[model samples]
Target: MSSGNSRGRGTGRNQGTGRKQEPQKRESILEYQKYENKMIRVKFHGGREVQGVLKGHDNLMNLVLDDTVELMRDPSDLNVITEKKRNLGLVVCRGTQIIVISPVEGMKEIPNPFQQ
Candidate 1:
């Protein structure tokens, strides 16, 4: 009876530990996959940004931006990027590119501004 109890406790702890690790791998794969289906916002250096679905990526990872963008949900405000903001456009090159792929939930709301 004593040996059986110890085995049961060991099994229970192992099961709990296994459960936690399983989701993390699944979550990362889902994150990468989100770029394929959903619309993404790509921000470039020199203070330029574009909102569009990521259609393709080159060997150099330069993005091809389309003229017509399907804006699913506004990130903050519709007019977050104003006329005063400079260098804001599409077709980001290799050197000055910052691609932010949208998450599966559309736009993941975080406690504070952070990137994964």
Candidate 2:
């Protein structure tokens, strides 16, 4: 079967162009080097928080954490973390789901400012 148009008919991405396009470089915003091998807490978009030792991360923001454990929220109150839910050991926190990344040592619990 011979088609009339053969120039622009291929399964390749650069079908019409003669040369292939170069992929843009992706750079990571967080300095993983500073937090490497240190305890860090990552908060997800849905208020889920996880604590672990920072291992590595990619440009897309996906982080590899060692000894990862998800913080369990109080059964009565979703705003409070009662304890650790499970020991994940090793886990990858997706960049898209992560809302905050902070050092574990820097975190402190304070009384609610709005409670009257």
lDDT tens per residue, model 2, 1-116: 88566575464677667887689787776788899999999999878999999999888889999999999998788889985577899998999999999998878978999997
Backbone clash tally for model 1? 0
lDDT of 1 by residue, 1-116 (tens): 36355444446544656554333332222233336535566555544455654555554456554442433333476524544432333444462356454433457545645534
Which candidate's lDDT is highest?
A: 2
lDDT of candidate 2 at residue 112, scale 0 to 100: 94
For model 1, the local distance difference test gives 0.47
TM-score of each: 0.38, 0.72
* Error in Å for residue 116 of model 1: 24
- The lDDT values for all models are 0.47, 0.88
